[model samples]
Target chain A: METNDKINQMNDDELNKIHSDSLGLNVPENYFFESKNRILNKVVTKEEPKTIPFYRKKTIWFAAATLTLFLGLTVCNKYAALDEQKIADQLTDSIAQIDNENGATAVSKNNFNNQIPNISLTAENDILVSSLFVEEKEVDQYITNCILEDM
Target chain B: MANESDFIDQLISETHRDNAFKKLLDLYQVRLYWHIRKLVITHENADDVLQNTFIRVYKSLANFSQQSSLYTWMYKIAYNESIRFLEQNKNKHSISIEDVNTKYLNCLLEDTFFEGDAMQLKLQTAVSELNYKQRQIFNMKYYDDLKFREIATILEMKEGTIKTLYYNAVKFIENNIEILPVKKGESVQNTENI
Candidate 1:
């Protein structure tokens, strides 16, 4: 009997009967049961019929985009407010320093107003009006007058 | 047991799907586990593949339209899952399929779940030496006790091809297994003729 012939003779039944003893492997107890639960958990997670794909939910993405834009605009507005406040603080401090230096002479409000013409204090851009109108020669003359008045 | 179509319907039916699938698991889990274990060659690997197989079966149950028997479809899935698992490992490690199969068989020796004696180890080595597809075909035919026609359906190959491979696989095993003797009339064929 050739090898092939002999093998053909040992068909499914004979082969199984002979090899079952050797190959009958074992697994941990309750492995299948616990593993089934695990599989079921995965199945439940996968089979959500009501849930839509992330890309398809355009409204949610749009809402997110709008919210992000709104937050960005608000942050920019806050920065602008802080910058304007910084300008106002610097302007107020400068004005206080000048007032302190000239406190002794006590320049009249109308005279000081006339000297620094159109000294507008506005909240829009927190600008100071010191050099808006005064020419260099006129500013030198005003400084001399103030110094003379102080003396 | 329900008839084939009834069983498939039960497996697909939402009301009866769980119960039917549980029965399917109970009926086929041990056999399928062992079948996958033989191909994959470790209890742990077998467990993973077997779970994947059943989950696939459950998911594809609705799409099953009785084109083939449920057994054939499930077996096909089990075989595919095992192949997928091995292919994944092979690709991840950049190894040939033969090298992966050898590694799996070598794993059997040190695997705690494997309680095979020396002869059993020899059997495993002999079976492992067969070509990969033949090894699976042989195991399906021999251990799983599946008919060649059913094996063909599961493997999605020609029944004749499965039969030829199985016989050749058996011959190869007979030659390799040390304890399996070439009896009085059985002679080893020449390499050229074989």
Candidate 2:
């Protein structure tokens, strides 16, 4: 029985025949091949920058312009700040000069008012000499005190 | 070293002089797609991953080493890329063993991308029973017809380990098929054929 079974065993040709007996299945004729070819061609095709969307191109240009403007403004702001500081300094000097003139005029008027009795009683010649000498001395003393206080 | 230099020269010259890259795309795209499809188990995801793989290959062609065959290196890249895609999408769906096996089987049955021969179907069934690494080794070796050494380079495994995996996978398929029940005349005919 084992010898008969051994004789009955099929060979490679018989197996090939069995496989061949089945229906031959070909790839369906459909859109897949054409679509795949289209995809492949699209992938391999060289695309230029112009082919990109307008919005994206515009965004790139906008970004570049914005950066350039920002840098230019930053440089301009630095120079502008320096010029503003110079103008501010000149205005501050003018204000200091006005303050000095007002202070001196107030001191002189106070001295003149305090010598009222001598100005009313005396004739013009006598009052003028005394007033002039006293005022000169007072003004000298006032100027010395003002200089010391300032220092 | 000389062989490596020669291969690099060939690749560089091919890049410069000919459209050999289109031939490469035709040869590798389907195989790589199927390999990635098995891992990802979704046609759309597989398609995207396959395109990304080719794009990366095109970008990094200048830095490619010639120590291995171009296919081996490409397979390695594709395998890693598939794993990375899986990792990135791991949160989208929780993958289970049963889910993986069922999806893999269904993809093989439904995918129009491959040549659906009877032997290919049988091979797919055989592969479905294997563990993940075993399935990978079997597919690379049997379906892709890659050498064990090339597979080792692709999978970064020892050659001996890949050999053992292939052997075990084949044995498992054969044993599983042998134990299936049969009718009397059918059994007699099947035994006779064997």
Candidate 3:
């Protein structure tokens, strides 16, 4: 074991000597320039514009077009709904005006009738009795017609 | 309010500046490259890892809190890059380290790179004999002259463990050196076996 240790030490010394001796093996003068050129070539190759895969480009275009179509449809629908609401509002306003005019005419006619109380009550009673008679007669006629039709 | 501390703080804050990056590269490139080279065992692999290490340092400079020494952080990056490179290349080679050594030996014998350099040949043999971790520890400690503390930080290991690995590696190299033939016409020295 001791001998082995000594031999190992000797080997280390010898290796160290070789290492020192081999130091500064003169690199050829153009070595660095050549290496630089090689590196530059590699860099250029890496930086060159790469053609995108067809599927990837197609997917990007498809996504963009789909997005634009969706946004356009959403905006168009929103405007269409707004226009529909405007037309509905105009119709509702016309109906409300008609109802107001009818209510006013009915109140005015009631006020005019109040100015002629005597005739108003008699006329109203006559109208009521006539409407009741007409209704009853119509019912009797309907029943007679029904009986005749059956016969 | 020491001047030196202020200067170091200013320097760290300016690490994003081109001059500061150049300074850092000059200071650390060789050391980091050698550290990486030892693990990957190829110059090209080391260069790639070294470049990646610097690029990472550049990208992460803004996040560098001077909590640890710059050397420690840089080494950690280099070490990780080296390991990653090794793992990436391991599958491509389709050979284990033992097989790699045999191939390397065959290449060395035929190649002119180490012609007439018996010491270099012997050194290669000795290094090849080490296991992966031992080679890493040995190279970092001996070749890079890194302290056990620095190695521990880089490797994310305890200093005591690094020390043990270094000792074990040295022992392995020493025992294996004798088995290797010295040079042409040299008799083998009979050394006491471990």
Listed in order, each prediction's TM-score against the native is 0.59, 0.51, 0.51
DockQ of candidate 1 relative to the true structure: 0.13
Candidate by candidate, in order, the iRMS in Å equals: 9.7, 14.3, 11.9
Tens digits of per-residue lDDT, candidate 2, B100-136, equal 5556767555655444466546655666778878877
lDDT of each candidate versus the true structure? 0.70, 0.59, 0.60
For model 1, state the Cα shift of residue A13 in Å.
Answer: 16
Task: Please give, for residues B12-61, the per-residue lDDT of candidate 3 as tens digits.
Answer: 56433554555455445555656765565545556687777777776676
Which of the two candidates, 1 or 2, achieves a greater TM-score against the reference? 1
Model-by-model DockQ, in order: 0.13, 0.03, 0.03
Model 2 TM-score is: 0.51
Poorest lDDT segment (10 consecutive residues) of candidate 2 chain B: B180-189
Question: lDDT ranking from best to worst?
Answer: 1, 3, 2
Candidate 3 residue lDDT tens string, A81-104: 566657655655665566587764
List ranges where model 1 is wrong by over 4 Å.
Answer: A1-20, A44-151, B178-194
Best by TM-score: 1
Find the candidate with the highest lDDT and give its number. Answer: 1
